[model samples]
Target: MRVTAVRTTRAPAWQWAGCAALVLLGAVIPVLRFLVFWPMDQWQVDVEVYRQAGVSILIGRPIYDAMTEAPQLLPFTYPPFAALLAIPLALLPFGLVGWLWTALQIAATTAIVWYAGYRLIHRGGSAQPLVLGLLAAPMFWLHPVGDGIRFGQVNAFIVLAALMDLRRPRPRVLSGVAPGVLVGLAMAIKLTPGVFVVHYVINRRWREAGTAIATAAIAWLAAFVAIPSASLAFWGGALQDPARLGPNMGTSNQSIRGVLMRVGPSGGAGVALWLVLIALVGWFGFRLARRAWLRGDTVTEVAAVGLLACLLSPVAWIHHFHWIVVAILAILGADPLRDRRRLVAALVITVWFVCRLPWWGISWIAHDWPPILVGRILQNADLAGALLALWLLAWASAREPRDAEADAVARAGERSAAPGKVERRAASEAG
Candidate 1:
């Protein structure tokens, strides 16, 4: 798991200033307009839901029984351990927590780039910060990422945890905490991260997988110890009811099931179709993921699995698509200057996500447009993006080095540019 660390040069003052400007334009302003000040802003209501769940724990109210205010009435949909963790937010003022939470999401997004795109950005040497700022500016405003910050969501933290867990020469965390512990904690907070367990099993990383399962179990046991009734409520039934998450047939839900629900196919046939599609995609996605790992591309392995999680989850909100950020880094394997095809592909995906294409599709539908087919396709743009990412990930990593001749050529090229086995070992891998 050792990586060849690149020697870094001291950044000039102008480099730091340029990086700050990019972040300010790309992230800070968007958060202010969309989340903090816009008339229709959600204003971090998700954070409010979390805080109220904390209040439920503190005041001895049933965790699931409590809901946010009218119009939304969002219930505490996370697991019991999340309620236990949210107690800290309960202790703080709502206003303070909202700002702090937004800051954390931004910081988490930065850490994600550091892990997923480390080699790419590090190549800039003294201009590394400037290059990162350039990447981060657009990254922060990605529709999915902006929405995550807008509603004070936790997806960024989960993304970071999963990436760090699988990253080569895994990044430092608490001493003796074990690698998969973060993945397990993420699962306890929201169940979607269970996909990573599937990834572990596929790669036969049995120790990490087992550690993750045990960690989640421990978190659940702790919650059960503190609030047996609440823990029972959540594990026994709350996790099963997908409807509690919201309208599955709605435009926001972009999973295979969600798309089929919107298609309005017949009953038994539709169920069969949904199940069939799920199996096909999961089998294909994981197949490629395993290949990427065997070929030594941990970045693509995680990115592929993360995209599968987003596409397969029964209720993927717009905010949950934050995985796109990581996928971007994975697709941009090696230097863009040398990989023009990868560069164009990455840029296309970026611009596609930057615009609110799905909402525009809905608006077209509302206006009774003649191009209904185009509108429908546009509406599912994000889901389609996930599928495209899976295929591109395979093309970019799993299928490369088609023969020893090509592999050797690629290796020689990498060696000429940088002197390290790590640089040649991975297609979408950490430095």
Candidate 2:
């Protein structure tokens, strides 16, 4: 009777704490939106772009030609398939849509922590809700994540979808769609996620690669069927225009090419330099990603590939760095706090990203400060961190020997499943 009474007394206190945690997580974006959005970004401007694209679809305006009203005048730069998906946002008032979009971003962020941070959450025992809520709150404020909320960007969804495609690779969607479909849809929406398809290919996930290709084609084809002109405009030329994204040399453009544009040679020389560097980055990044894969660390594998996408893109805005959220989880690994070194590394990385290092770099350059070198380094902080992360992940993965038994089993499964209907199922689980 005494134990039961004590347990009952603590139940409400635990529930209250859990509820408080949930509220804190929910408030992160709202607080950031009002108190923390940077001067450069217009509030939810990308959402406005998406909403306007939907309006374009409903009103028969050319999506590419249509620009958001006022000074920003941002045009729709995403593929036609994304425009097709935005039709629903068009139906709602912008005010309502903004609120809903913010909520969705929160949900997506929570889902990401849930998926990638599951191992940590699992060890929390009866305190999973408290653990999840607390973990999610800080993640929501990660610069990229906050930027996603402020700009109403689609990046959180893409990260979540890609994570699910890799982490939980067996589930179906809407009762029919397969594991790779989410990644496919993501690629169709924005070509950035095409990196995931490359991951599948290099790893010889042929069926998944094929499924992703087919799914992306279907989406683009569907858009082509629905709005042939817009489809043609996107695939024909608009997709190639990096200019539409923004100033390449600006602080927000954190890709390697962006760094080169700011500091390296210009014209043909810059192009050649970027190409050489990109080729090297691709080879090295993929090698590390594959290393994480062989180590059976899905979080690191996904994180490595995601970092590659951000670093290699022609115009990766700050919001795209949200991939760092998972990378942080990967840094922590299964043991959240047992290893002092790991905990400190994760903390440093988290703090490094939360602060706007790149913008500080820009401030120094703008002010003509004496130590311009320090500023220059700070300006490309995200890119530098990404490269360093790849190296560290590769090094860490190298320390562990390969699982010969698992490799042997995968090979055997591959052999028997070849030319068979269950090949994809076998191959997917074998790894």
Candidate 3:
């Protein structure tokens, strides 16, 4: 008997060209910023807050000390470890730090796209265009990556973390650790990533989930120990903060709440509707994951699960949907354009950026319409856009299942349960 190892192959020159083109587009975005005539002050809002937080951390000021005199004006709501993550860059001057940080984020995005392409090719065992399509998926190109980099955000790190954990082998205690750290760090920076933890637990990834909880606990504990008073203040105000911040479902939030708020007032009724919607989305996502897992879907399906989670969240922002990059790549890994559903998914993803165009063109469109009406229309557009994104998520989740690895693990577990399987159990235990 002979044993053989299977290795995935590379695509042809045209496919290489396609990958190169996508890479080129990604690389050029940062450099092309000068051509856009948006309000420079608006751009400064998010960055300036982070820069101040970085500055405060460098000094002896508490991590949660008001960058603005107001307690709620911190540019974001994040845990303490978020400040710790920015400590290294805080050492640099602000201009240098922002540029360097943005560059690194762009690089991270490229790396994730490349890894996603690699994973899809490795698992799909198909032609180069398929690999190229996966690499250049519109969902990957537009939306989160575009807006994330344009805003100099760190969501790409979150994308990388989730992608790294997909279809990881069983007994992967250590394999789960890195993603756990990343998830914690992402949550530390922004609370939105905390939702991923819940998704992990729902999927029965107990080890990784435990590690995620532990990592976040340790990180926050360190921060609390360093700045007990600030931590106390945060918790003290935490209960009242959400109401003060307003429901995210409003158009202002670019979340589910934002959509409902656009429909009506963002009052108690709106909040109730948001909660019910969230429950429905979560139920469907869980069912989708179980079906895919039971049907023996590949690791890529985990990405689809992530996309569903994001859609179901009440507060997912445009930039927050960056996880779609991983989801599209996962689908590509399982099927090519020959798979019509996947092809349409790719097209829908490609066109998603169109929603942002209205906001971008609002300034340029000096129309005769009343200012209030224009604002209302833009808000309605955002609401529509959010729903479209959710629709795409539902479509992807319903596609063909690919849980080959999970099925194999289930079979292995069944074998272990059989009589006279003591030796196999012992070997597994030893490892």
The whole-model lDDT of each prediction reads 0.79, 0.76, 0.55
Given candidate 1, what's the lDDT at residue 59?
93
Q: Give the TM-score comparing model 3 with the true structure, all chains together.
A: 0.74
Summarize candidate 3's per-residue lDDT along 321-362 as a digit string, tens digits.
Answer: 676666555554444554777667655655655346436435
Off by over 4 Å in 1: 1-8, 12-14, 173-177, 398-431
Q: What is the Å distance of residue 83 in model 3 from its true position? A: 0.5
Candidate No. with top TM-score: 1
Candidate 3: lDDT of 312? 63
Best by lDDT: 1
Sorted on lDDT, highest at the top, how do the candidates line up? 1, 2, 3
Compute the lDDT of residue 39 as modeled in candidate 3.
49
How far residue 57's Cα lies from its native spot in candidate 2, in Å, is: 0.9
Identify the runs in model 2 with alpha carbons over 4 angstroms from their true place.
Answer: 1-32, 35-41, 168-177, 396-430
Q: Which residue pairs clash within candidate 2?
A: none
- In the order shown, what is each candidate's alpha-carbon RMSD? 4.6, 7.8, 7.1
Candidate 2: lDDT of 140? 67
lDDT of 1 by residue, 44-129 (tens): 88999999999998999999888888767898899999999999999999889988998888878877886787667666767867
Candidate 3 local Cα displacement, residue 183, angstroms: 2.8
Query: What lDDT tens digits, residue by residue, belong to model 2 across residues 1-431?
Result: 01110010122367547845684656565556643554444667899999999999999999998999776789999999999899999999887887788878878888788677765654554565676787777786567877788788899999998887876222223236665788898999989889989989999988878988899999999999999999999888888887888787888898989999888999999999999998899999888777677656677778889989998888888899878888887777655455556567777778877787888888888999988899899998988877776666665445444333322222222233232222122233424
